[model samples]
Target: MPPRPPQKPNRRMRGFEPASGLLRDRIRTVGEARGFAVSRLLTHWAEVVGEDLAARTRPVKVGYGKGGFGATLTLLTMGASAPMVQMELPKIREKVNACYGYNAISKVLITQTAPMGFAEGQAGFGPAPKAPPKQTDPAIRQRAEETAQVVQDGGLRAALELLAQNVLSRSANRAVTKKG
Candidate 1:
C-alpha cells in the first residue's frame, strides 16, 4: 500500500489569546440576549455618559422597537438621583447617540430604587470620605524628592515628589505582596 500523507488539522492551535478576545463572542451573545445590542453602551457607560452621571446611574438594558429602531435606554438610579437623571434625559440621549455614532437612543428612562436598594444595589452619589494620609517611608520620600529636584518651581517640585513617592510606594507594595 502507498504511504498516506499526514492529514492536516481543520483549525490551527493558537497560543496565549487574550481573555477579552476569547470572551468577545460569548459576551456579545449574552449581551444581545439581555437586550444590549451594542455592548459598548454597557461596558463604556462612564465614557458614553459623563463621570458624574455614570457614578450616580447605571444602565440596565436597552429596549428596541419591533423593527429594532429607536432604542429606549433604561437606567437605574437611587431615588434621590431620579429627579436629576430625569432632567438630564435629553442630554443623556444625545450623549448615548453620540457614542453609537448615530441617533440610536431616542428615549432615556430612569428607574428609581430605595437608598439601600433591592435587586440592584444603590449606586453611590455621595463623595467618599477621604482616607487618612499614610506615613511615607523615609528612604522613598528622600528618593522622590531627589528625582523631583530638576523641576524649577518649588510648588511643582513638591507635587512631583509627592506623586513619585505615591507611585513608588504602590509598586513596592505590589512587589512585597508578590514575594510573600
Candidate 2:
C-alpha cells in the first residue's frame, strides 16, 4: 500500500454533530416512512411557507408518480380556506420546493375537510401559539446573576447570565424528572 499524505490536525474520525442528533435522526426516519423525504418540510413548515399560509395549511404527504418521476405534495386545510389555498398553490409549491433545495415538488394538492375532520385540524386554523419561556428556579437565577455581575460589559454580562440560567435550569429539570 502507498503511504498517505498528512491529514488535517483538526479532523476527527467521529461524524459531524447535529443539534439533536439522535432524536432528529429518528424523527427523520419516521417522516421518510410516511413519504416526507424532506423532514424539514414537516418540522419547519411555518418557516418555509410564511406564517400566514402555514397557519391555514399543513403538509400531509409527498406522493410520487409512477417510477418516482414527479412528486405531488398534499396539504390539509379547512373547507372555507380551500379556495384561498387553491389560489396560493403556486406559491406553496414554490416555497416547498425551496425547502427541498430543488424543484422537487411538481404539484400541490389541497384536501379540505370540516374543522375537525378525521381528527385532524384539531390544532386549529391559526399559527401555533408561542410557548412562554420556562421560569428558571429562583435559586438558579440568583446564582447566575451573581456570577455574571462582575462582567464589565452590560451585553456580555446579560448573555452570560442567560446562558448560566439555561444550563442550571436544564440540569435542575433533569434532576427532578429523574427523581419523579
Candidate 3:
C-alpha cells in the first residue's frame, strides 16, 4: 500500500485574535464620526478627570468646527454642579487635551441637567447585599450587645451590634474551616 501525502494547513481558519483588535477599526470609525479619536476618553473619564468631577459630570460629545480649526467638548452636569463645572472648564479642557496628546478640544460647553436627566438610560449596579443575619453563639451575641451599649443613639447601637455579630461569626467560621 502507498503512503498518503501530508495535508496542507487551512488558511481560512485563523486562531484566536483579541476582541479589541478585531473590533479596532469599527470602534475607531464610530469614535471619529463623533469627533473623537478613541473611546478611551469616554471609558476612562474618571481617570482623565478626577473622581469628584467625574461623579458629577458626563462627557456627551465633541463637535468640530469648520476646517477642523476649533473643536468643542460638551459635558452634561447636574444643575447644582453646572456652575462649579463651568468654572473648571479650563482645567477640564487641559486634562482632556492631554489625554488626546494635543490641544484637540478648543472649548468646553456645559449643559445643566436635572439629577435624573443625564442618568436616565444608564444602568447601575444595585446596592450591595446586607451582611447575613445568621445567629452566632449566645456568648458572642451577648458580648456584641454589651459592647454596643455605650453607643448614645439607639440606631447606632443596633448597627454596631449587628456589625460586631457579623464579624465574630465570619471569623469563627473561617477558623472552623481552617481546622477541619
TM-score of each: 0.58, 0.56, 0.53
Clashes of 1: 0
| Pairs that collide, model 3 | none
Top TM-score model: 1
lDDT of 1 at 85: 85
* lDDT value, residue 135 of candidate 2: 79
Candidate numbers, best TM-score first, in rank order: 1, 2, 3
Q: lDDT by residue for model 3 over 4-62, one digit each (tens)?
A: 89999676756887888778788778777777775887768889999888887877789
Estimate the lDDT of model 2.
Answer: 0.86
TM-score of 3: 0.53
Candidate 2 similarity to native, TM-score: 0.56
Number of colliding residue pairs in model 2: 0
